[model samples]
Target: MDAETLEIRTIEVTPNAAGDASTLPDLLAQVPADERITRVGGDGAYDTSKCRAAIAARGADAVIPMRRGGQPWTTDAPGVDARNETLRAMKRLGRTIWKEWSGYHRRSLIETKMRCFKLLGERVASRSFDRQITELKVRAAVLNCFSQIATPHTIRVA
Candidate 1:
């Protein structure tokens, strides 16, 4: 990210975040239990009951994929092997809607939001961690406070 007021700062490298239930709990401890988290999308990495419980505790609707050797989300659904085969052969236009399709559609929306936040908010190229967080919060607060000024209908440049 770009530095403060476009000022450059020394970078500090941290270890890659760890995985597993214990790791998740420790890392997310700062997040309040009552915070209204809507949805959490995760991969096979989140398999343990503790992971699920922790997410659900935040009142979030989790969309984590059940890991291999773990309980299936739906017993009637075909195996991953078959699903992979279908995904490889089918095109988006003619293919039937499936679980992967749902995930892709939803994930794309999230990607768009992040891209907009990065571009319009000048948040993508941050100088440091604290600056990055500040930029995001500042952008959101500014937008909320001056929503009408930002809206196309009310914007009349003199």
Candidate 2:
């Protein structure tokens, strides 16, 4: 998402406190502790100790990769040994994804979706935080509805 429109965040931002990072933890607190979340995938910025510990407390696996320059912990977990093999396989798969010679590339499909949102000419006429949030929700809802309409259905006559 562009800096102008949306920030990619795991937390939802209400209009009252949009664009404010200070409100995130308080918003997170409002979510019940008992609710079970499975794997959470995010970039390393969400790698704060508190966030990690909280996820562990809830019995959820954090799919987050370890950040650089940290002490590597040694633990014997199943499927953990496959990392080296996966990197080897990535060499082959990564080449085709780039359409030429290979180097690891971040997937751009999510960025493409964000670009589509911007291109849709969604109304951002009001700079007021409430209006921006209201428009964001409407845009998301409309996008989902359009996906439902655009999906093809197949029928077979007996």
Candidate 3:
């Protein structure tokens, strides 16, 4: 999701068996290579090494909060240093303060957008996987259109 535009930049409809963290890499891969991604934000569920590594691979800062009682990674992995640094910051500043400092609250906007998406239709009418994907994409497009129309354009006058 694009924070500035409130658009669904990419969407992936995975099977129920696939976990959010596990499917994150595939979602990140869908993003065009040329697009510059500065930050990837998500809930604690996305704090896994795989998700962090995927974000790091795209050269984006991970804004995912660590899970409660999470331990630092013992391996020398691509995202280990950043994740550990975030963990240390969380420990030092405290979770609430760290979240405020890191702008984690911006994630709530995405969550609200998702809720609105779900409100459009909780269940997809299509039975086939391909159709389901198309259905979701169409819904997202419609939502994006609505967001674009509703958003106000403001100018500052001195």
The prediction achieving the highest lDDT against the true structure is 3
- Model 1, residue 155: C-alpha shift (Å): 22
- Give, for candidate 2, the lowest lDDT window spanning 10 residues: 98-107
User: Which pairs clash inside model 2?
Assistant: none
Please give each candidate's TM-score: 0.40, 0.49, 0.96
Tens digits of per-residue lDDT, candidate 1, 1-158, equal: 11111111112223347444455545344555554556555455754556566665665554544444443233233233323343343333333353455453465554444454456654246778677656666664543344435435546799
Best by TM-score: 3
**Model 1 bad stretches (over 4 Å):** 1-38, 43-50, 67-104, 121-128, 140-158
- Taken over the whole model, the C-alpha lDDT of each candidate is 0.45, 0.47, 0.93
lDDT of 3 by residue, 81-136 (tens): 99999999999999999999999999889999999999999999999999999999
Model 3 residue 37 lDDT score? 92
Error of 1 at 112 (Å): 1.1
lDDT for position 127 in model 2 = 86
Prediction-by-prediction clash tally: 4, 0, 0
TM-score of 1: 0.40
Q: Kindly state the number of residue pairs that clash in model 3.
A: 0
